[model samples]
Target: MYADEICRMMVWSRGTAPATHDDAEHGSDPLTREWLVTNGLGGYASGTISGAVTRRFHGLLISALPAPLGRTMMLSDLSIRVVTPDGKVYQVGGQEPWLDETSAEVIDLAEFRLEAGLPVWRYEGAGMVFERRLLLPHGQNTVHVTYTLLEGAGPVRIELQPWVNFRPHEGALDRPVAGPYALTVVEDRYELASPSDLPPLRLQVQGARAEFRIESDRLRNVRYRIEQSRGYDAVGEFYSPGRFSLELPVSGSVTLVASTEAWETINALSTEEVQRAERKRRTRLLLAAAPEVRSGPPAELIFGADQFLITPAGRVEDAARARAGGDEVRTVIAGYHWFTDWGRDTMISLEGLTLVTGRHTEAGYILRTFAHYVKHGLIPNMFPEGKNDGLYHTADATLWFFHALDRYLTYTGDRETLRFILPTLTDIVEHHTRGTRFGIGVDPKDGLVRQGEEGYQLTWMDAKVGDYVVTPRRGKAVEINALWYNALRLMERWVRESEGDAASQRHGAAADRAKASFNQRFWSEEKGYLYDLIDGEQGTDDAFRPNQIFSISLPNPVLDPARWKGIVDQVKERLWTPVGLRSLAPGHPDYKPKYFGDLRARDLAYHQGTVWGWLMGPFVDAWLKVYPADLAGARSLLAGFPPHLDEACAGSISEIFDAEPPFTPRGCVAQAWSVAEVLRAYARTARSAG
Candidate 1:
């Protein structure tokens, strides 16, 4: 059975082809289908497969500042022109004129595929072949564009004009770039500085004779239709400091490297060499995290898991550890195309992204990294981009941290880690028992965690639009209490293992009380499942939601085993789709059908009825827990995500899907927990098959 799944998953090697456009509609919008490549430092190069920009985030060099601190869009596009020996000029790669318009297929695009996550575009026509490839080095901000000339394609000339920008990823530039760019043409290279402080961006043409035209021009009114629909500034302006025209030889390759400071080192290496080095580096890291490097289906998942692991800026303690020859700090970005290193995402993604992948060193670093930022016993809900301190609004990110760390210890038996984070764990328990941010505290009477505030969405179902807080699961949300009960149990076990007698006694008593209270209030004998939450904006929100899965799915199950099957059955009966579990059941009046339109429309559907891939992990966990004897059922559910890997973002899982029939992948194209949770569930399901 595993072999069959592995055989089916081999589609990742060929990847998905770019959808052809017969019209300018979104169904045929070239920019609607995108591809991305990241440097483990949180920097990435992403654009449509047709080489068009659809979002402000599209760019060739989105540099990871200092160490995944923030991202900046530097090189917007490299318009490529190819001249055949017969004097016929071919604009194989240009801005919207060539990227989107079907009339621009004069070059006759032959093929496009993601070879090892690298986007490759091939154009063949008029007895000439032009192939464009894009890759970002493992830990560098450089975007390498390689043009390989096939034999018999005739000797030709290739010109590259780079559109440069210096701005944040989310912003748009409507005016011309300010003066004093300090453009320079040196021996065999062209350099330009957007700012005085940032290193000069080096442009190198490998082995081709270069003619530099030192000039500047603004390409105005470059519109992003996707952003327009999202109700954002859709038009932008870009300035190119210069262009490079180079003479090429048949059967030869020329690479243009756009990078800061690394060009001096990378200029000597060919594009093939860089790709080979990157592949080797990625394989090493992937293997380090996942020792199970068998030629099977999970290999594709391991590849997906590697996308979220980034080398973040080391703190003072991390620098000290590095100086002492200890491991460097690392964290998981929540998703691609937008999200930063979120605390809730990192903690929830820990097991599958790190532990199951055999990344023990990174697991230790990630746990410690978040522990360093624990404020008042609450881990941050989100670590805002470009800053050190994080926002502490979550009622569950702190609790999720406990579950993540406990799983880490279970997988590695790292006693040293337990001892190290003991104080922080103790503080979390005490703070939650008393109170933390976002009105989060353990009720003294019931010992269950209660959290919620007017106008604040504290749980994972967080979606807000100005004054409207979507899914404001106010008090005693089902999943928060489940995580709360699990965290207490984890603390009790950690204390016992670490030989903290007094702490163990205290945590044990707390865990027992929380579980007793959880069972008493959460279960609904009439509904045959758990209540979604108590004391919602109204009274108790008995609306069927997948959140109840956690009561049985977690490593530390809080509900009685006798009632476990009922929760799983309810979720499977109503919320379960072929893709994932819906946030809300279908019969509810508030349940939304699809996630689309502007901010308000999207947010309304977000937690109301959108399907979440991450939820499947818990759903599967609950499935197996209730029916440990049902391996077929577990395997059947695990098969749901493989098709999704190819749908939106090749080789990665999407964050959420539409709730109605014909579920379409939506939200982030590559989400961390989406991929991680699916991988984690796959492992558990596979274990039962074994």
Candidate 2:
């Protein structure tokens, strides 16, 4: 099963090293490259290839706690030290203190690679070779750290020092978890519990002899270098319960299971069995995808796409509500490290992550899950971390919901689910027709939906800092109206099917009015592109932003076909980059070539000129509309992404990048929509070209 896996192996070798020795390759620094492993309940383990904890979010275990607590980091790190028969001790992981000049250094990190979606590292020292692999068992809040003596003499003594912390994953370093932590041990198994309502962290060993030594202490001033560079509170303090000593012989192996789950769940499967099951599960995902995309970049994305589709375990109420309704609650986490499930990102990513991957049942579950949360004619803009209820402030996510449903119906021909949710859809359209929260409604004057309110960021360009909305886009946003027109057309068609044309006449007439108004009002005669927003707070915004691409990209394009070529060409000439379309054109006065610095600085440039990886999906759709025969050209536009899977976050895509050359990857390491849109676009092109 593993022999022909396209993205299964990524080796980083220092130089002309042996087949067993792997380090950074082609001057590509492994220190900057990161790897992630996720449990289907919104819990994950992530860190740099160099073994440095660059973010507070990096941990061996970040468990998802049911509502009001969210995700909590239970295990910060576990450093390994190897002592051979030759009486030599070497630090195998990395430096202890992030920036301590005198800290013991990692002697020889010979190699690093991803073997079957697992992060593996090899170290050679003391005439022996040691290899370590990390895995997070599916659907459980546990992480398995397995060690193998790939090449060695005999009888090597290994010391494992486990550091612990109890805090919200997004906790600040200033408020360190000063706790009276308790450590309980019962002959080979250990449990570390906090003073708060958080659950205990269980630790156990398998496949080797082990001993636990009680050495309670604190590792202070451990700096997260990446966070420091981002102008955040980078210094953190962690608690240590003790150390474990284990022995391994030639070709021997050992496994350490660290989890917050109960003992039964933790001991449910042996480490070997768990590994085999996970591998088989990933294989099934690849097989489910379209035949043309069963290998290469698309194959890797099949795994990447799976990382975002998770059960909302933290939102217990939502889960109960869903179960009562005979459905499961599945949603897409917007991105890794910080983002929760957002309505817009989920709907935008649904087709790529679920339908295209051929997990139609889970796809239906995700849509129905979001449907259960629809309120006030709006789907949730986002669910706040640690909270059960969602915040309904967006103007576009609900409309995108309609588009997602249309895609679902087109793919599965499932009329049953549509019939079930038709009332919800009808209610949404009615609310938009009259009005909803955040000043979102159809303007009778032009039949275009307008959205905005002081102190609110309604559109996806939404970036607010300290009560200041960066790109408020408080008006009839081009994409919003395009989505509006699309939604109206879909509603018209759907109502006609469910009922008759007489019953859908209102929706049909509304669609006609919106389409006419969209073409007339959005087209910029002099600029050769659509206006970013019409009837804005400060009048019309003629910004050359990528937002206008949606005018021709949706299933039901609002823009007239006569002007598509001009829009596509203008976008390609001014906003196009190999990685993605620039949010704002380079020549715009507000354009910032780089996205970096403190929160305010990053926010200002976020929607101004940052290159969004997800925008490539829309650009390809628009491009294909303009030049239907240029499938190769459309495929070439995505050439920059295949190599990118090895960067930022190994085997996944980034949220955004710098607008200029080098195009540094930024924002969340593994973004849901970034992987979704790329996979969606690549598969679409492959299907058309084939």
Candidate 3:
């Protein structure tokens, strides 16, 4: 067999650089100082300053709608400004209207102009703003603006405002979604007299402070209270959806309370007790802890929270419906539904949404939705939500499906369900073996699968533009081969366990044959590291990339200990980042440090060199598995995760970061895989330790 013919290679020797370069770089001046703030719910605000030029900036991005009682209305207004070191004030809105793109239509919220001493910009709409001056010397000053919620006649009375602020310092910060202003909400209620029937109820508010209050005429005798904790803050007033003002400093907590008649009503049904029970239930459904971090309460949990705060009746069903919308809110709730969604996120999310969150039916529906589009043995690259077509080019989706199906079976244990999808699995394997997209067909010469083209993104380093694929590996990729190995193993297992047909025995034999062939052709003796891929010329480049991590990290290990250790050492030396693992080595010819240029430029650099937050999952998994004997070392390696988790958005993980030092969080504010992998890894390590 090919596996038996392959020879094991010795570990590569490590090199040491002079200590001068390290010490010299350590004393560089600080680049800039930026900080983040948020509302307890989901909105975020950040401030940044460029130390080089001393330019100050502030930005706010809102992610939720405001609700009064149980109704929400369109966002009406927003405003923001900054006080300069020279005592000159710069108003944010007066220059250009801030555009809100969180929804389909972009609303221009900046409208006010400066009429006096300072360049003050004001935006007036359904929301109110208050101006207050502060005393400071020429070197430093403070400017404050407040937003007041306005009342309107709408059936539903609640408004969820999404906000974020960024101050990049030297240059202008990214425009705030709306006006850069503090948000606030106040509630007012009144009743109308009736001759013989029930009285009418109403709720209203004013101000924009990322805060709201709630009051009800029906519960006039009751009062609601707000509480703050180490990392959170809130203030309550009355309108609907129970209004409240909240400030969540990173790494803090806050709680809401209802008093008097409202308390009595809530207490009558043991609403607090019910809420506690629900929280516990939801937490258990989404909880996944690794050696370092945990990510859960999943999309369904957030949806449940939305329903809890909005409508009490049919809340679970309402959450399901809301998730189906697939908008940014739904996307965020889902924690990073990639634009190109094959099964990577869809399958991983199942663990949280279906297996853990108790929404198995939704899990089945989403799987079926994707399975319906499988073509030529290939799962989709992603589904076009607005269209009816799928981009079928992914190698891992089908493989992931087997795993997801297995997980779903473990949770639901419904043989009929498993049998229903068995054909899909079989078709995928058959398609790959026969022939598929790119050159990803089985090669009889070596039994190793072949894939990719000059400018086509086949494997996951898939950053591509119009006819120009960056980081194209037109050969056999490391991870794809690992996935291939896994697929064969899964097929053999499935066939033996479920189908039990004689043909399955043939499939098992073929799988065993392929695995042996993979080891012989892919392992590099000279470099002591597995080649990332084998080119058409049969030459392998011994680059230290993350793809090889899967071979060892996965439940099925394909490489022997010597080869696995060599790859791990190489990866740790080159690809590891304090925040996460970089996509490409910093020393690569195409490496770029700056990632904030035009969209096309940034996208090209995205996977080619950017450090993805989700890669940490496999990296952590591989590290822990390889270093299983070093329990303390494994835990120590993950210690950066909790602080990184806490430092980024509150309880949320960023999508990607710059590969170089001062690795700033980039891409989406919250990512699904980042949370999923972290939570899953954390849970696995924690379970093992326990």
Best model number under lDDT: 2
Task: Give me the displacement of residue 363 in model 2, in angstroms.
Answer: 0.8
**TM-score of each model, paired residue for residue:** 0.92, 0.96, 0.58
- Predicted candidate 1 versus true structure: per-residue lDDT over 393-435, tens digit per residue: 8888888998998889889989887888899988888888888
lDDT for every model? 0.76, 0.85, 0.44
The C-alpha stretches of model 1 lying farther than 4 A from their native spots are 1-31, 67-69, 93-95, 98-105, 173-180, 195-198, 262-270, 289-297, 314-325, 500-503
Report the candidate with higher lDDT, 2 versus 3.
2
RMSD after Cα superposition, model 1: 3.8
RMSD of 2: 3.3
Candidate 2 similarity to native, TM-score:
0.96
The list of candidate 2 runs beyond 4 A from truth reads 1-4, 8-28, 95-107
Clashing pairs in 2: 12-23, 13-23, 22-111
Q: Regarding TM-score, does 1 or 2 come out ahead?
A: 2
Model 3 poorest 10 in a row by lDDT: 134-143
Residue-level lDDT tens digits of model 2 in 307-401: 89999777667778888988898988999989999999999999999989999999999888888889989999998888888899999999999
